[model samples]
Target chain A: MSAIAIGLTGVTKSYGDKVVVDRLSFTVASGECFGLLGPNGVGKSTIARMVLGMASADAGNITVLGEPVPGRARLARMRIGVVPQFDNLDLEFTVRENLLVFGRYFGMSAHQIEAVTPSLLEFARLENKTNARVAELSGGMKRRLTIARALINDPQLLVMDEPTTGLDPHARHLIWERLRSLLARGKTILLTTHFMEEAERLCDRLCVLEQGRKIAEGRPHTLIDEQIGCQVIEIYGGNPHELGALIRPYAQRIDVSGETLFCYAPDPERVRGQLRGHTGLRFLQRPPNLEDVFLRLTGREMKD
Target chain B: MWGRYAAALPANAWNWIAVWRRNYLAWRKVALASVLGNAAEPMSSLFGLGLGLGAMLGRVDGTSYIAFLAAGMVATSAMISATFETIHAAFARMHHQRTWEAVLCTQLTLGDILLGEVAWAASKAFLAGAAITIVAAILGYAAWPSILYALPAIALTGLTFASLAMVVAALSPSYDYFVFYQTLVLTPMLFLSGAVFPVTQLPDAFQQVGRFLPLAHSIDLIRPAMLGRPAGSVGLHIGVICMYAVLPFFLSAALFRRRLMR
Candidate 1:
């Protein structure tokens, strides 16, 4: 088997005058969890669709599970599982029937589907809601069922687009656990998400996209350490340049977003000592993480 | 154009059956209600318009008025049943329920989903069309074994109407938009297609318009079959109905490819 699970080379797509994915390229190694992190409409979902062969890219090439996309995409898709952004479970079917119908789409036999249904249900932690209609399932249960349905064919590559979006904290944790289990079992996952915590937790490596272009790509922690340093000091509601000048001797980088000014440095104490006399400034110091790298790379502008 | 059509074809011919089965499983829950709903409208027209109106008018076209109307009812019922299934029910699956989007995520292509939907709609229309034919046969309004020939014509009519309605389904922005198709297209087509009256009775220009209507082609085949007479120009009638079935399918596929896949 090829080490590369998904490979995109200079892939570009345009809708009329607007470019959605522009000369973007990446590859996911087999059994690795790779995340595509970007704000809304940055072509994350479009890349996911192109990888699945649901949409054709205008330029360059894509291969999934060693099969060229939009050409042998059907064959490639037979081994690919997808957890779409929204819960699109069939409201007409019970929990079991949803899996049954989805399995049939992959040409799985009745016996094969019957054998797998119970285990998938168990994997999704929905053993008790076996025959319940999709509408009857709670939001979390519906999301779990959607994941379980995706696994019926035991696909080689699992593509999840914003899998945890709109999920409550508890539900989000449960999904993260299931995903971790899949990774433990050597499943290659290609995920697209806006949740920095999700990417930091689940992804082995990730890329940051802005305006349909790759800004940075590496391990989550490595990118954070390299891009924003070890510490982030947030000084809220003050003149950014005036406060930034206070820490200029200690801080490596200074950035302003909205009402807060961020001071990044390797040593927190040196930066904090500079603000010791600034009691009324309402500043706090913390370790830098993925969000700092994200906001720094992609900016804090709101994207609809 | 030919290349695009080839690309639009299902990857595997039989893969569409899964989509058909999905719909069948869903419809099974409301099977009785769905079947009754399809049959009730046509049966009422048979009773109210065919019998009541037939009594006053007596005989036309050298046969009883109700008998001539029975054939029209079969064709009209099939058309209406298929149209509603595609425009309203299939639209719900496509736009509101997002079932088609989910299906696309699988190995199935848009062509497979559409083929399944069109087949299912045609099947539903068959049931409604068959119910009228059987009732007419039982009531001595239609010829015995010869009326059986109308069954295939009815099914074909379903395919024609279902395929045509898919164009409307693909283009409609919401359920509200269906009213335009129903009012401006379908209801007008019902009267213009010579389903209830002979096209010969209309002005020559109006009669020319009827020749292009899909239902008119369907009636040309079905009415003769129901009346136990050999149909005239069977090749032309079948050719026109087949054209209606095929042409709009590609149109819908093109429209949906832009709207959904893009």
Candidate 2:
């Protein structure tokens, strides 16, 4: 087994009376892609901060890259790269200058930064925009540049917080492609995202977080099969309460949400057969995925 | 609590220098425009008030009135330049640009970033103070080599003001909040500190309050040097300015630790 890149034991954090992270414990092995899935204000960002030693944990210990956090965190940070949620690229500098300045933050010499600039730009697919100002770049281009800047230190582990949020589908696809390349290169990655599809596509193993606690932890497909089932039959436009009752006997589990009845079953044909004769019932049948598992574990409530 | 943060700063100078270098590089892009902009207001005030008002007031302290006002302008320029840099420019980096957040993700600590920012603002203050001194020297209103003595005094004055304004930057939530600091604190301090005229000319009550102002001590040190006179209470003046510089730095650092780290 590979060594652990990140490890936490009974970590807890609270602000005033509100406990942000409560007894959270997990580990990501070296060269593996690990995802932290949670809704807003569930303390995903707070966990990222604690692991980086940017914030202190009220209880328990955190180790990253074999160094104790909030103690030797500075030394650990030297071998780690981070892509924060928001774009904080130096708006004053050009594309090359942004990378150059970021490298200096890690104490890398200008000569060393310049030597890697050409390849780094190519990695982000920003070769043509080398001299362009960051403000002039598109949203996707800025996000890519942020990723490239994080790699300036040649770090062993990459910690990214929602690295692809707010991007269009095409842009998101490109980011995922770049991330896959990094994983192939044997770099450990810790990613946080609200997008379950992103977690499913990229993360080798992942954990679901709710109210500062780990609710589920496993491979995406395994969690889907174990926690949910083989298929989900969505029925809309009919009375959700009556339809939920009618399909309950055939489904492994049934959930009614705002004029829609979600029926989870091992076989889609069984649930579909029960809904066929129902008048004015709109239905969609697809294989059970991570979102079903995620929503089932964390619920579909809107969160801040 | 303050000692913990003070000890957190790296013993090596290179990290803070890197932070300084980042700001220098960004400032270099607009060096000409920025330098000219800082020089304009003080230069105009020096010419407008010094030449115009000096004609009516004449000499009060055994030198020409314009010569006296020139020294005060140097101190005032340093104060305004450093204050603006910290409150406006540094506030933008902390709040709007989120530059400090990016830097914190690296190996550098919050103490390192704060030192770098304070150093950079002090550098800007030095330039602004030096520009006015040079102009005053060129115009023959300031002593030849004696004004050289005022250069270090101007730098200390810069450090003092920059350190003080950083506290305001830490407390402020927006650009609009800075106005309260400027109007209520900086403006009154300017008038009371004898930048425009002699402190003795004011009422006894105002003079007592002026004794506590950092700018007053700065002017006391700088005015004598610029006039080519033997300055009195040299150790006391330096001590006061140093106190202002050191104490506020710790205060601001503590405030920023609460603001950013949480």
Candidate 3:
């Protein structure tokens, strides 16, 4: 096993009476891409803040890069890079100046920052827009620049919080491709995201969070297979109660979500055969995925 | 956790230079506009009150009215520059621009950010105060050599107001929250602190209250230096301004830690 890069032991945090992060524990190994998946207000961002020492854990302990957190946080921060959820780029500065100033914040000298500017700009595909103000950059471009700024220090571990939350598919894909290259070069990453597809594509191991507690955690494929099975059959637009009664014996588990019934089973053919003669009912049989596992673990209720 | 945070404070003093440098780099693009804005108000006040009002009331304190008003302008301008920097500009960076959040993500701690903000405000105040002093010297209201004696007091005035204003910044939730400080505290301080008129001329009770105000002590030190007269109660005045500068600095830091750290 690789050495641990991040470890939390029963960490708990609260604001006033509301417990934001309950007794949660997880670890990310070196060179691993770990994802923290959750809905809004589920303590995903709170965990990220605790790791970065922005918010202190009210109970238990946290360690980053083998150093105790909130104590050795400044030292750990030297080797850790962060891409926050919002756009905190300096709006008064040009794109190049943004990178340069961030580099300065990490105690990098002018010569060092200047040496890496061209390549970092090229890496973000923003060579031509170096002089553009932050307000002028498109959302996609700004997100890319934020990622590039995080790399200015050449950190050993990168923590990205909802990196592609508001970007277009093309923009998200571009970011994912860049992250893949970083991981290929042996950089450990801790990612928090709501997009299951992004987690399935990028994360090596991920944990699902619900109301500050860990609901499920494993390799994406392993969790999906263990919790959801091999395939899902979605049957819609029919007498749902009658169809569920007929499909129950053929499937391992069934979930009803308002005019739709999701049937989970190992073999799609067997389930499909049971509904062969059921006309006027639409059904889609496909392989189960991380979304199914996530819904199963965190439930289908909408969270505020 | 609080003990650990307090321990991190002393070792991080020089780290705030990065935040100060960052602000300087951003300000470089519009340096001329900012310097002019800082200097404009004090200059107009000096000329307007010194020449316009001086012509009516001649030599109230054994010197030309312009000469007497010149020293008060130095103290008041420094106070205003530092106050505005810490209150409006610092609050904007903390809440709206999120610049402090970006810097805190680095190795720099919250203490470093607070010190850097106070230092930067003092630097801007010093520049404005020094410029007004030079203008006063050219206008024949101040002796060139005596102005040098007042530089330390001017810097102390900057730090005092900056640190005091940071307490307001830490407590403020929105831009509109600043109006209370400006109206209730700053405007009253400007009038009662002997910046526009002498505290001795006020009624007996108000005169006693002015003795405790930071601005009154600042003007006490600066006014004599500008007129080339012997300074009175120098140790008491410096002691009061230092108390204002140092105590509020720690208070503001504690408040910021509470506000920023959840």
Candidate with maximal DockQ: 3
DockQ of each candidate relative to the true complex? 0.57, 0.58, 0.66
Off by over 4 Å in 2: A299-304, B1-11
User: Which of the numbered candidates is closest to the native, going by highest lDDT?
Assistant: 2
Best of the two (1, 2) by lDDT: 2
Report how far off residue A73 is in candidate 1 (Å): 1.1
Ten residues in sequence with the least summed lDDT for candidate 3 chain A: A295-304
Clash-forming residue pairs, model 1:
none
- Pairs clashing in candidate 3? none
Model 1 chain A poorest 10 in a row by lDDT: A295-304
> Where in model 1 is the C-alpha error above 4 Å?
A237-241, A280-283, A299-304, B1-7
Worst 10 residues of 2 chain A by lDDT: A295-304
TM-score for each predicted model, relative to the true structure: 0.96, 0.96, 0.95
What's the residue-level lDDT of A133 in candidate 2?
A: 94
lDDT of 1 by residue, A80-151 (tens): 899999888998799989999999998889899999999999999999999998899888898899999988
lDDT ranking from best candidate downward: 2, 1, 3
Candidate 2 residue-wise lDDT, A112-161, digit = tens: 99999999999999999999999999999999999999999988899999
